[model samples]
Target chain A: MRRLAARVAPPTATFLAGTLLAELLIRALGVSPLLLPTPSAVARAAWSYRETLLPALASTTGAVLVGLAASVALGVLAAIALAASRWVERAFYPYAIFFQIVPIVAVAPLLVIWFGYGWRAVVAAAFIVSVFPVIANALAGLRSVDPALLDLFRLYGAGRLARLVKLELPWALPSLFTGLRVAAGLAVIGAIVGEFVGGGGLGVVVLGAMRQQRTDLVFAAILHASGLGLVLFAAVDVIGRIVLRRWHWREEIP
Target chain B: MRGSPIVGLAVLLCLVTAACSRGGPPAGRVALALNWKPEPEFGGLFEAQRTGAFRRQGLDVEITGGPGAPIVQMLAAGQMAYGIAAADEVLVARDRGADIVAVYATYQTNPQGIMVHASRGVNSLDELFAGEGGTLAVEPGLAYVKWLRKRYDLSRFQIVPYGFSIAPFLAEPRMAQQVFVTAEPIAARRQGAEPKVFLIADSGFDPYAAVVITTTQRVRERPDEVSRFVTALREGWRGYLEDPGPTNREMHARNPEMDAETFALGAVAQQPLIEDEFTRAHGLGAMSLERWRVLGEQLQELELLDQEPVAADCFAAF
Candidate 1:
């Protein structure tokens, strides 16, 4: 009971306090529902439109998960290639930076043109926006090996593959997980942007509701989108902890 | 205090009459919000402001542009005195208990339609649906698309998301897309493609566009002001049709992104549609109760509106 109370009380209290304050402030100011709907109205709307919102929420979450998985797989491989030689990094690194710099909204239309719509374009959009962080972080971890350890490996006449697999890859885990965490959030944003151009998901609901002037529904879409991002972030954090502990990665790093 | 009572009373009465003579105490300030940036689509409203027609009616009008801004929502919230939106949008708002009323309509027919390459030999909606199944780019959540799907047995066409640009349509010749009749055809022509246009209104689902709207509270509290604004708007439309050069120039100055050719073409193409037989017979910016009823029933049939709003309640008297 004490453990449950300790874990749950703070968040519940804070959320209740925030909701009460928002309700009171809006009521006092008499703000228009169009400009800003009250908390109770938003909650009611969220419940009323749960049928529509749930499916959209599921679709967005599915897109984000698929895109994030693909990004992690490609990003880690690219990072390994970069770590292998200076020439490889010089040739490919600029393109990664370019992808990051070009706004996702601008490229989304092109994705539709190339991929011909649907979740493939959405997944590709999320992958493009999210892959760079993993590449950068993994490369940094691979290259940050201790000089003394390198000397020991060389003294033992360790092969390139042996040195990489035995030492550097394990050291890269923490940095790779950090990248994954950041990419997880970005993946959801990319999915929403893709949906904005490619259609299907909470983005459609939000845009449609806004156009229709259903502010309450718009608020509901927002809540779902944020909840999706939060869940992705939290899932990445949990997986990182378990993997890092199971492999004794933390102890090996220092 | 020592002045004669008769002289004081005569002076006060003269002052009060003088104030009323200047069009009833310096007409109220009104903000008229447009859905998109300043362009030929809103030529009449822009002309009204530029030509001081609104001022003559004792109104201080502020014409503002909204790039995807919610105009009807703002009006319902009493944030603005007037706004221009599509009739369908007003119906949706009304269904949600918004007290907005459509005062006048600028477009006699909706310009929304599907455009396809002429080479594809898909001349009509039926042909496009029956043909070897290419992608149809449309905005998500468009009520018209839903209506089209339900009205015509079009199960073969694959629905793809549209990005509000003509580049995708240009690159893929066989692909069909939704477009504004006055707008995208010009863009496609610039790209060396003659798009076969199909106006959605011809399908017997015409909705008013560039509809002038205000709240019911305003209609009850200030009916005279609403009437004056609508009258000024009518004159503005006539002036715009006669010689749109000045209004076009002014709009181009405000929204330089619209190229001169496209702006000119839009101004020319829009005039005929804006002044169709109905508008010609009734005068510019004219709307009738019977027309509103027809629109209301169509919307209800489409399920765009949850319930049919009384036509009289939806539009105010001109």
Candidate 2:
């Protein structure tokens, strides 16, 4: 209990203090609710609109997870292939850079046109924005293997596949986790942007609320989106910690 | 030179001149936020600026473009002097503790509607509803959509999301999409698709559109300014209806996304809607309490309102 309280106390105290200051300042200044709702008002709206907010949260979270999974799988495979051949990297890496440089807003409408609306288009948007980091980091990890280790594998008559499985995979795990942590946050943002153009998420709720001048609901939607992103990032961090621990154990075994 | 008598005298004269100028306030600087870009939907405001109607009232008005919800938010926050919003939106805003009052109604009838391809053979509302269930691209939870569901039996149609794009509707011939009666039909025709339009106003649920809104604080504190703004807006509408050529050219320059044909179509479609019986009886931008009452009652029945607002309190007649 003491350990948990020590961990929780700072954030809880900070949040309470911030809320108190905001409430006092808004009341003292006679600030208009339209400009910025009081924290209590936002909490009320969040509670009242939970029925609508829950499904939007589910839809966006589902899209982000599916999209992140696709980016990881495709990114890992492409990195392995690119590590094997300099010729392939020279020919195809420019396209990956191009994809990363292109803004998601410019591409979301085109994705809607091609993939036809709904979650498929949203996933494509998420995938487009996040896949590059995974590929670049994983490729660097694979290529940065020690020359002495390569010589040892060669002396043992180890094939390329065997060497990659034993040596490169272990070496690449930490870098891959680093890329994924970055991509996880980006994937949530991509999903929201996609939903702005394509529809069906908290973005839709925010847009509708803004149209009707419901500032409270708009803030509530934003809060939900931020919470979703935080949850996703935390999940990725926990998974990374577990995987890195195993990778360290495997290194010790050798 | 810093402390000489001549320098002191010059500085004194400068301060006196500055005080005189500052003491006599310049024309009350006001900003009017419009519902959309400077299209015909907002021509009255542009017309006001073009013809110096606001200047005549001792007001230097800045007409800027924004979406309806943000415009209302700005108006309620006292960031803007006036804004354009729908009557339903005003009612909602008022219910949510925004002290906004609607003073003018530009579109005497709501111009919102659904457009379907002529080839789909859905010419009328009943047929469109009774036909085999197909997708109608509309934003869910819109006031109109909720009202439509309450007013009709529309279980057959499945509403997919619409993001203000005509490309999806063009790609799927069977799809019916929400559109403004003045805007989308012209764009559709230009794209070589003949669409059959159904006006939401024709269904007898007529809410005012492009309503000129201002805060109750402004009305109470500066009633004269509020009155002048509303009157100028009315005159501006009348002037635009008489001849929209120069005013529209100026608007097109500001909003190049709309071309000549779209502007022309909007002017033609909006003229009849603007000069209806209520406007003719009172003046341009006139609204009736009876109509607002009916709308409020309907909204109450639809459960859109947590508590019914007194309709008279929602608007101020000039």
Candidate 3:
């Protein structure tokens, strides 16, 4: 309990201090709520609109989860195929990089045309934005197997399947988790962008508030989105620690 | 050597500042931020700028255009001297504590409407709402949608969110979507789709469109300048209606996404909406308090506004 408290204290203190300072600054500056609502006003708006906001949160969370799962499944499979041979990596790696570089905003409208303006388009957007990191990191981990260990496995007459299951797969776990963490944050962003273009989730809430000139509500919705991203990232981090604890115990030590 | 580099940096900065200020408008210059991209809806503003109507009024005006900008906030925050918005938007902004007042209304009737495929056999909004359900693409939280819900039974339609695209409507014969009467109908026609538009104004929910707005502070502090700007705007609209060829060419040059043909079509389509019997006697860009009051009441009935805003306070007719 003490350890957990110590671990939590710094961020808690910083957040409280920062929020207080912001409240004071906004009051001192006499900033208009339409321009920038104070933190207190944002909290009030959030509480007042919780009935609408909670459902929007659930809808966006569903899209993010489905998109992240699809990316992880496809990304890991593609990485394995690429790791099987140098020729495969040479043929397909550039395409993965292409997905990473293309801006999602430009592609979101096309998704609407294909998926017909609903959750499916949003999931496709989230998947497109987040899959590249997983593939890249997992491939890097698979390729970084210790040469001496590989030689020993070869000397033992282990076939390709045995070598992969025992050596490369375990070696790649940490790097795959790193990629998953990055993809989790990206999935939230992609989902929001999808919602912006295709309409559903918190993006619509933000758009409606903007059209209504409800800046306080806009700020409230943004805070909810950020909270969702943080929750997703923390879930990935916890799962990574648990899975890595057996073989990669030292790194997991607090 | 270090001091010499700093000296060179200072010289560069001075040169940049000189270039920025040189040949620019004078200190008294005012700017108008448009709520949408350059199109026929903003034809009169472009016409005024091209023909030196503003310069003749001794006012140097810089007009900037973009899609879905926060025009009311910019006006309230003093980022721009004037902006273009709908009368409903101005009222919503005032309700949200932005002290903006509409000075001139461009379209006597709102141009927003529902565009249905001609084959859908949907003649009236009632038929569309009451008939067998089909997909209707619209922005969900707009005041007009709420008003429509109160007045009709829209439960039959599968209302999807409209994202300013006509692709979905073109692809699906059974789909209907919201559009500006002056805009998407033209684009859809060019793309070989026969689209029938049902004007929302005909449903008794008309609010003035493309209203020229400014901070109430500006109206109170500089009434004469506001009057002059409105006068120049009226003359510009008159000229545009008389002969839109020159102004349409210039606007097309600025916004090449709109071809000359599209500009011509939009100009012809929006003419009747801009000039009608009311504007014929009251001059161009005229607004009445009764219309503002009715709009406010409608918004209040829809529960979008906390209360009915005072009609006189929402606009200043110079």
A1-254 per-residue lDDT for model 1 (tens digits): 99879978998999999999989987786555655678899999899889999999999888888998998899989899988999998998898787677788777888887886788888888888888888888889898888899999999999999999998988888889888888888888888888877778887787667666677777778888888888888787778777788775353321
Q: How do these models rank on DockQ, best leading?
A: 3, 2, 1
lDDT of 1 by residue, B193-230 (tens): 97898888888877888899999989999999999999
Query: What does candidate 1 score on TM?
Result: 0.87
Each model's RMSD to truth, in Å?
A: 10.7, 9.2, 6.6
Q: Which candidate would rank higher by TM-score, 1 or 3?
A: 3
Q: Write down the TM-score of every candidate.
A: 0.87, 0.90, 0.94
| Candidate 1 segments whose C-alpha is farther than 4 A from its true place | A1-5, A20-31, A38-51, A85-95, A247-254, B1-29
User: Which lDDT tens digits does candidate 2 get at residues B227-247?
Assistant: 999889888888899888889
Residue-level lDDT of model 3, residues B1-318, one tens digit each, is 111212322432343334333433356899898877789999999999899999999999999746655677566556678999988888888887888999999999899999999898989998888878788888757778877889889888777677777888999998888889888999999999999999999999999999999999999999999999999999999899888899999888888977888898999999989999999988899999999999999888876775569999998988
Measured by TM-score, the strongest candidate is 3
Indicate the DockQ of the complex predicted as candidate 3.
0.31
Question: How high is the CA lDDT of each candidate model?
Answer: 0.80, 0.80, 0.85
> Model 3, B276: alpha-carbon shift in Å?
1.9
Clash count for each candidate, listed in order shown: 0, 0, 0
Per-model interface RMSD values are 18.1, 16.1, 12.5
